[model samples]
Every structure is written in C-alpha cells, then in structure tokens.
Target: MRDAFVRALLREMARDERIVLVTGDLGFGVLRPVKEQFPDRLLNAGIAEQSMVGLAAGLAATGRKVVVYSIGNFPTLRPLEQIRNDCAYHGADVKIVCVGGGFVYGSLGMSHHATEDMAVLRAIPGVTCFTPGDPAETEAVVPAMFQTPGTCYLRLGRGNEPHAHEEPVPDWRFPKAIRLREGRDIALLSAGGILVELKRAAEKLAEAGVSAEVVSFPCLKPLDREAVLSLAGRFTDLITVEEHTILGGFGGAVCEVIAEAGCPCRVHRLGLKDEFSAVVGNQAYLRHLYGIDGEAIAEKAMALINEKRTDAGRNP
Candidate 1:
C-alpha cells in the first residue's frame, strides 16, 4: 500500500515541480525511488516530526505542494499542533501522510500504534482525512491529494494489503464512499485499511445465508453521508468497522450521520474498544484479540441478522 502511495506521488511530482516530499527520517527503502528521482524535492527532517510539519506548512504557504511523511503516530500526533495551527487554520496545502496505521507495528508497542489519529485529525477544521482501503484507493488518493486545496491527512496501511476496489476510483477530486458488494439484509461499512478484512467478512456472511453489502469509506471526514442515508433505506442494520477506536472514529462518524437522518436502522460499531490492547504480538494477533478481524465481523453481522429476524417473527 505504501508502494502505491509513493508510485502515484512520484508520478504527480514528475509533472508538478511545485511539489515537495518531506519525511521524518522514515520510509528510506520504500521511498528510495522518489528520493533518487527528485533529490532536491525530497527532504529528510531528521527525527523532529514537529519541525518537519512546520517546515511543510511554511513551504505550502509559499504556494508549494508539501507532502509530509512518517510512520505510526509521528506524522499526525507528534506534530498535531503544527497541523492544527499552521496548516489547517490557514488551509495550507500540506498533505500529512502516515504509514503503519493501527497495530501494524504491534511488536514495536503502543507508541507505534495510530488508533486515535482519525478522531483527532478530523476534529480540526479545514483538513481532509483519507484512509485508502488498498493499493487502488492509495493510488487514487495520491492524485486527489495533489488537487485538494487544504490541509489533508492520508492514513496509509502497512504494505501488501489486499485490493478492495477493482479499478481506480472514479472521484479523484471529490470525497465520497465507494460501494463494493450489494445486499439487502445488512451493510458492512469500513474505513481505512480495514476494508480488506471487511471484504472477507462479507464472504463469510454470504456462506451463512446472510446477504451483506460492503461500502468502503476511503474518505473519513466529510463522509459520504448521502450514501449512508441511502443505504439506511435498504438495509436494516448498518455495521461500521475500523481499526481506530469507536469513539469519534469511522464508526462514530457513521453514527452521527444516521442519528441526524433519524432513520430506523441500527448501527453496530465494531473496532478496538475504548481501551488499549491488553497484549500484543503482531497485527493479526492484536486484531483478533480486539474482535475486529474478519471472522469476528462476520459473527457480529450474523448476530444482527438473526436478532432482526427474531424481532420480525414476534411482531408479525
């Protein structure tokens, strides 16, 4: 997925000399091609995330397209003040990119986890938040980031995630949700890197005689509210899945939309609870422990389907 980000970014940089890539001493190997091809446009900001962001903001203010890169929470959390003040407040065109979201760096511990970044960044006004589901979405987001006019957050997953979309998304300039699989019983909505697992869960739901619709929310902020409202009319249950905490995260974003629409649909928010990981070994193990994995998602979907059936039988 990181490769997809760099590849698209490289293409954009080749055409636009105004673009600059700044890293906080990370992505050396993965971003090698970019560095080799455009040495002057690329910068290593050492280990200072805050300074790197401040510099990016300054560059953007001068009519330059600045893309700041780092891993885990370094890009978002470490320089949050810079993002909120210099970038977002001014609507500067600084694209803050973070790799290894969630527990992708589980062995490295909680310091490397990025479970709360979505909620934190989205709270800041004038910033666009994007969590591309796979290589395709990552590619689409790159060009979109270049075209967008304000502060942006691009949350990237660990490399080698499964492809969720069949082709490049249609909307490169606007923010919206993309529908994957169609069904009537339930709709499984996912944001960020979790779409891969969410797709697998839809398959499990199919085998269990439950039809599940899958929607990928690559754009977190300014969520595809219209899509959610339309889906509410078709499905009884809307289950939101994300790697972040349920509070003010992807799930919370959907809940807000549903609440305002005053729809009769029930939304089940599936994610790492409002707590940190109890134990960690790897991304897979940690996701399983949190019950946000594919199997767990499938199980939760089934429970919702069955419960709705029981209610129908009693009411009828």
Candidate 2:
C-alpha cells in the first residue's frame, strides 16, 4: 500500500504542478521519489507535526494542493487541534495521510498506535475519512484526495491487506460500502486495514453452507445510507467489523444508519471492546488477544447466522 501511494503521488505530481507533499520528519525512504520529482513541492517539516499541518493549510490557502504525511498518532493525534480548527474549520484543501493505523505499530507500543484516529477525525466537521480495503483501493483513493477540496484523512495500513478489488480500480471512488458478495441470509460490513480478514471470514461462512455477503466499507464518515439500507433490507442479520474499538468506529456509524433508517434486521457490532490494546508482540498477536482475528470474526458471524435461523423456524 505504501508503494501504491508513492506511485500514485508521482503520477499526480507529473500531471499537476500545484500538487505538493509534506511530511513531518518521516517517510524519508518512502517519499524519496516524490521529493526528487517535485523538489520544491515536497517539504520535511522536521518533527514538528503541528507546524507541518499549519504549513499545509498555508500552502492550500495559496492555491497549492497539499498533503501532510506522518506515522500514526503524531500526524493525526498530536496536531489534532490544528487540524480541526485550521484545516476543517476553514475547509482547507489539505489531505492528511496517516500510516500504520490501528495496532500496526505493534511492539512500537500503544503511543504510536492509531486506534482513535477515525473517531477523532469523524468528530471534526467537514473532514472526510477514507479507509481503503487494499492496495488497489489505496491507489484509487490517494489520487482522488488531491482532486477533493477539503480536510480528508486517509488511513493506510503498513502491509498487504485482502485484495478486495479484483483489479486496479482507479476509476472507483470511495463509497460507504461495496458489496463483494451477494446473499439474503446475512451481510457483514468491514472497515480499516484488516479487510482481507473480513473477506476470508465471508468465504469460510460460504464453505459451511451459509450464504454471507461481505460489504467493504472504505469510507466511514458521510456514510452511504442508501447502500447500507439496501443491504439491511435484503439480509435479516447485520454484522459490522473493524480493527478499531467498537466505540465510534465503523460499527458505530452502521448503528447510526440502522437507527435512522429503522431497519428491522438484527444487528451485531463486532470489534475491539472499549479498552486499550496491551503491549503485544505484533499486530497478529494483538488481534488474537483482542479476539478480532479472521477466524474469530468468521466464528462469530457463523454463530449469529445459525441463531437467527433457529429463531425464525421457532416463530414460524
């Protein structure tokens, strides 16, 4: 996904001279090409996250498309107030790209973990959040961020996630959710960097002779209510999964939609409980400890489907 972002940024730079990239003393190896191609456009703000964000807002005010990049919390959490007041409030055309979302930083410790980024950004008015499912979606959404004129947050994972898109979906815009499978029994909605696991869970459910549809939710805020409602109408049971805490994450957004639309489907929100992640070895271990792995997700989804079927039979 990092490679895809660099590739897309290079392409966007060649096409538009006004496109600028700024990093808060990070991404030296990852953003080298962008620096070489557009030397004046790229700036390393030297560990000053707050100033880096302010710089982007200033550049945007002067008619330059600016993107501020850094690892996890420093970019989003540290300069959060500046991001909210300076960027979102003014509706600045600055794109904030965060790398290593959720527990991807793992042993680097919880301070670097970006579990609260989604909920934080979602609270800021006029900020658009984009959490792509894979490299293909990453390639698609990154370039679109340049064209979009507002404060946008891009949640990028550290490595390969499930290949949600069969091919390079460059023309694809970020939607509230994309239905990858079709079934009347249940619908599973997923968010953030771990979508590959969600798809695997869907396939496992299929092998068990249960029909499950997977809806990839790349965009969290300004959710596509119509698409969610349409899926809810078809599937009698709804489940939402994410790598972040269930509070104010993807599941929270889905709950809001279900309440507003008043969808009659039984809903289940599966994710991290309201708690801080422990100091674990890596992302995989941490996910297992938290019970958010692919196998765990599949198991919970399967159980819900079976329970719903039994209830239906009893009532009939």
lDDT of 1 at 229: 93
User: Model 1, 1-316: lDDT tens per residue?
Assistant: 8989988998999999999999999996998998789999989999999889999999998999999999999999989999999999988899999999888898888888899999999999999999888888889878877888889999999888778877777665457788889887889998898887888899998998888899988899889888889998888788999888999999999889999989998889998888886576798888888888899999998888788789999999
Write candidate 2's Cα lDDT for 1-316 as tens digits: 7777788889988998988888988886889888777788888889999989988898889988788999978889899998998899989989899888888888888787788888888889999888877788788777767777799999888855457668776566656466677876677887777777777777888888877788777777777788888887887778887778888888888888888888887778877787887666688888777767778788988788778779989998
Q: Using lDDT, give the best candidate's number.
A: 1
RMSD of each: 1.2, 1.5
Error of 1 at 286 (Å): 1.3
Once superposed on the true structure, which residue ranges of model 2 sit more than 4 Å away at CA? 160-162, 174-176
Error of 1 at 172 (Å): 4.9
lDDT of 2 at 206: 82
Residue 287 lDDT in candidate 2: 75
Per candidate, the number of residue pairs that clash is: 0, 1
